[model samples]
Target chain A: MSPNKLLPLLVLLAVAPAWASEPAPARQKELVHLVRQDCGSCHGMTLQGGLGPSLLPADLRDKPAEGLAATIYYGRPGTPMPPWKQFMSEAEAQWIVDKLMSEFPQ
Target chain B: MKLILSLFLAALLGACATPQPLRGTGDLGLVIERATGHVTLVNTSSRQPYARIAGLGDLSHASAVYSRDGRYAFIFGRDGGLTKIDLLEGKIVKRVIQAGNAIGGSISQDGRIVVAQNYTPGGIKAFDAETLELLAEVPAEYAPGQFSKVVGLADSPGNKFVYALFDGGEIWVTDFSNPRQPTTQRYPAGKQPYDGLVTPDGRYFLAGLFGEDGVAMLDLWQPEKGARKILENYGRGEEKLPVFKMPHLRGWSVAQGKAYLPAIGRHEVLVVDVATWKEVGRIPVRGQPVFVMARPDGRQVWVNFAFPDNGKMDVIDTLAGKVVHAFEPGKGILHMEFTPRGENIWLSARDDHKVLIYDTARFTKQGEIAADSPSGIFFTARAARIGF
Candidate 1:
């Protein structure tokens, strides 16, 4: 294959893992419960605001999804937002970010 | 005509029969639902929630203290709502919003007064336990224009309330023996006392320090000596993980003449000898320990951590001074309470919306009761215990 054709194949191989790493439907449901109830302990149950800030779609609309996912993964230092990396994978954090951007599950 | 009259008489007798009353040793309790500001009345014997009462307001960090008879519960809410709940009726008897922002509260030793410690517009207010009527206000003012947030308010032995000044770094004891003119005494504790609790025997009041690396202990038997720092520099040189939430020392684990305290920003519980006020050892845990609770018999210490690892739980054998068992009961395990004799442990898994009951002896899942986003579990048996 030509070099230009090889580049497309490399890109596809690189991105394939990311797409395949999405949490299973059952796992996604559990994560949804965790964010809504566990995280909701600090952030309000509706994600409005409490000990932590509002995590609603409207409040998080301005921030980039990737940044939010990173925050969820690494956590904000010196804050009550704990690192979810121990409990979740990078892909799972992204899944939470996507859910937060839309109407998060109750 | 005779047969009709007999049926009518039977129906009248059935209608007049009164309902049977609740039995068992008043082991009933309330589980604070943080999300919706409600409490679920639970009976340990039945292992089920009988009723749920709502509208206490901002129960995110709420706590409750029982009346002497254990029939009434005084719920202190985060939004400064003090609600007096009747356990038998499963309803709020009276509620009063006395502050802008409140943390927790304490009931006097005599059970006559209830005191709430506040954050916003910082002060402590005393109210009549029966009526929820404000009796007095003691502002935590360190300077002319500065007000310190109150933390770790606990009722000591002599009808007195003791609390820590988060901003002022001081511990104050207000004797409500007089009710109106409380005799106040101040002692300098460590920096930023986050939460405090009286010992089971009500001998010492220990406060966890947030701004520093030690705990301040005040001997209630000898208040003239003032607060002394223990376990100093315990976390001085160690690199700390980012603190998600401050470890609450209110429900600290005490068993067999020792205390198992959560070390801030560390996945370890500091074991302290109560007699010597010395660090005996540190038990490594699965994550940052939130509540290190001793079993009723002092044989094991059960620990639950902060988020990410909140799903995990560790059971430490008090004698071995090590984690014997670690399990994930469910996601978001918030609070735990053991049966009076420590036969079973009731744990609130907030994410699962269930309170799991585990057999302490066999360490097996016995049963579970459905709850909302539950956080704190308080039982009527606490009414008889000191510093519950």
Candidate 2:
């Protein structure tokens, strides 16, 4: 392919899926609420840790995002953390992990 | 004209100086607004909220214990906030950040002390009910540098407190007779005792196990004997569902001759014969039960569920051994409290931001009070109960 055509193709590939990767704005709000209320039942509402570990940026920084996403999607077996796949998509779980790795929304 | 003006000023001054009515807190209660760190001081008799007091932090998993007089409420917030609120005064008397993470707490039999259960740097700390001053600290350090999260801390008879160690798998009883220098007795409990409850009679301390099939029971009358397991494998040979939220058991779970308790990872409420301490029956319900409580009359049992199923509640007919009625109050049905005589039940619909009151006998809505993400509904009558 020509250089100009390749550059345009690259931009389209990069921009299109980026929007698709994260959940939509409305669903994003629901996911945030899920993390704050439902997940907050065991993990502290402040994400400071309770029966479950903390999800604050400091606590989640060292952990792999993929592992955290898997934990959310599949749940940690033999633990109280139940699988959330029925409630959210795997991509949504990854979005939650990314938010936890940074500062979670209030 | 000057004399008339003076008289008017005198009357206005007298009205301004007059205090609130001389009343008791017998009908007063509290509604914890979890998300906003505020508590609505509600009068159960009127089914209305009189005041909304704030500043208690991170009440996500908060629970409260009443002072002996029923005038003060000691709120234990998840963010480690131990706030003592004066119900009569409609204000916070005192608050302290005594830990990094606290689960719940209980008051002594004499009502002179309030003990808080902590998860971070796990331990149970005692404070003076009057001054909120530190009285004692019993570290849940089962092993060196290893502390277990304390759960189900209940005040028993003889001015003692009993609690379960989640990580250490033990039950510990401490006598607050000498508040500053308390003595503790430990008993080896089953694996992962998630919550503990002192029987209404104050004779037994039962720890609900999460990692195993049975609950550990200790006879307070005979402390020499070790804890024994009861309700062994009630759900054995069955596939266990994921526990979206842990079940909570209080002392008042017993009704008539049976005890209605939450079944871990199961969609039923396990009924055990209190006399024999064995599973007599089970009532299948909507989802994993969180709070299984019997009305003060013991004729009916009310229950709320955990996440994904958290919006529904079941009313069990104790005599029929089955769920007589079920209803979804709203999203996030967090907690429920019945009146002293069990005539009316208050249900906290957290996500709906309302506290709905229903008449127990007719199963009809009586009132709904607006709140901000309400969770726990505590009444002053709890002050007179043994293990509130």
Candidate 3:
């Protein structure tokens, strides 16, 4: 194929992975509720901290989003945090991390 | 003038009439609102919240035991605050901070002593049920100044309390026969006894082990025999997943001659023959089971999950030994309580901020009560049961 024809194909491939990484709007809503309520059970309802550590944006500012996502996906061993891979995918975990880093849902 | 005087007298009589108070009949209960650090007094008969009593501190992992009269509830909070609330008046009668951190507690069979299992100071404290006065303190000391957190504290037969030492890997039985100076007997349980519960008949006290694949069962009748491992290697040979939340053995169900228990780090319920203490069957569920409870009739066993799958619940047929039905009553379903006759089942959906009551026979939503992040549901009917 010519250079011009290959350019469009490369662009499409690059955008496809990004599109797949984003969870659907409905799925995002469910993830938000899960983090707010389920995770909120240990980490306070205000994300301030309770039996578990604080999950507020300020406390998590120094933590990278990728590390946070991995923690959510695979869970931290020896801690109360359990693996959520059974319920969500890695991409979805990344999305949750991004939301947590930003303004988390109420 | 005569007609006006008669109307005034009738109005005076109407104003003098006071509302009737709730009498103890094993129909009342409390829903622990974890986030708000309060409990909502609920009338299971009317399926309505009568009152919300606050001031209990750090209820993130709170549990309650009712008085033998079923009129008072002794709530154990995570912050080590033990509050005794009068169910009739819906008020805290006595509150005391007995430790630095605590998980749960139990009442003695004689109804004279209440014990709080601690995580901070690492010991068990016995208090007078009526006065909330500290009667005894037994530190769970394993090494020099090293105390193990206590778990699975349950009232056994003969006014004794049985509990597991999380760090010590031992089960201790404290006889409160004297109340003031209790005698304790310790037995080696498996590694990491996370939680435990006594059977409905108070014959067996089973503790769920987190560091291993099986559970430790203690025969209360034969205390000399010590704790034995039951359902050993139930999670053997499989790549175990991280346990998000520890399976609450308090909700372990016994029905139709079998005990339904949530297998740690697995999406299955292990059904053990209560008579044989052997695994008889395993039922696959949606996710990690949290609360595996049985109806009062022992015909159906209901199971709830942890974290991401906490929204859904499954019903297992005890006779058939299979999951017959699965439904999502609401988000963040925390606890379940069956009515005295098994006519209705009440579930707390913390995310939805409501408690959904279902008709047991048809499994239909009967009613819903507004609550504030409720987690645990306790009914007066539990006061009559063996291990509340």
Candidate 1 ranges beyond 4 A from true positions = A1-106, B1-25
Q: How far is candidate 3 from the true structure (C-alpha RMSD, Å)?
A: 10.1
Colliding pairs, model 2: none
Question: Estimated TM-score per prediction?
Answer: 0.80, 0.92, 0.82
lDDT of candidate 1 at residue B278, scale 0 to 100: 95
B1-388: candidate 3 lDDT, tens digit per residue: 4465336434533533444364755789989988778787888889876776879987877889988888999999877899999877767899999987778899888788899998778789999998999999999997678889888898887888999988898999988999999999999999888888999889888999988899998999997999999999998769786666667889566788888999998999999998889999899999899999988889999999987688999999887889888999998888988888889999999878778999988889999877767888988766766767
Cα lDDT of candidate 1 equals: 0.83
User: Scored by Cα lDDT, where does model 3 land?
Assistant: 0.83
On TM-score, who's better, 1 or 2? Answer: 2
Q: Which 10-residue window in model 3 chain B sums to the lowest lDDT?
A: B11-20
After best superposition, candidate 2 residue A1: deviation in angstroms?
A: 35
The interface RMSD for candidate 3 is: 3.7
Clashing pairs in 1: A80-B244
In CAPRI terms, where does candidate 2 land? medium
True contacts kept of each: 0.21, 0.68, 0.25
Each candidate's DockQ score against the native complex? 0.16, 0.58, 0.17
